[model samples]
Target: MRTSSSALFGLGLVMAVDRLVFQPDRPISDVQQTLLGIVRRVART
Candidate 1:
């Protein structure tokens, strides 16, 4: 449980950094977008 939670947190952190700093104006990578999608889907559940 902790491992999964930590992984989600880490993925979220990476997504946040990618959105805020790495690709603010530009498009994000497929990997990042996929991560974001997964996060969104998880949030809905």
Candidate 2:
């Protein structure tokens, strides 16, 4: 249903961000902010 799709979508986004964060060179604080914004947008959607 809608909730399951949302949960799956959030999980996919989290994993993508985790992989991106594991790579060299991105600043932690910037990543934090970006991830937070993405999460907020996902929730709003």
Best by lDDT: 1
Q: Can you give the TM-score per candidate against the true fold?
A: 0.53, 0.48
Expressed as tens digits, the lDDT of each residue in 1-45 for candidate 1 is 797789898987877787788778756576577887997897787
lDDT of 1: 0.79
RMSD of 2: 4.3
Shift of residue 27 alpha carbon in model 1, Å: 9.9
Superposed by TM-score, candidate 2 places the C-alpha of residue 28 at a distance from the truth, in angstroms, of: 21
Off by over 4 Å in 1: 26-36, 39-45
For candidate 2, give the lDDT of residue 1: 71
* CA lDDT of each prediction against the hidden true structure: 0.79, 0.70
| Residue pairs in candidate 1 whose N, alpha carbon or C atoms collide under 3 angstroms | none
Clashes of each: 0, 0
Instruction: Report the error of model 1 at residue 15, Å.
Output: 0.3
Model 2 regions lying over 4 Å from their true place: 23-45
TM-score of candidate 2 against the unseen true structure: 0.48
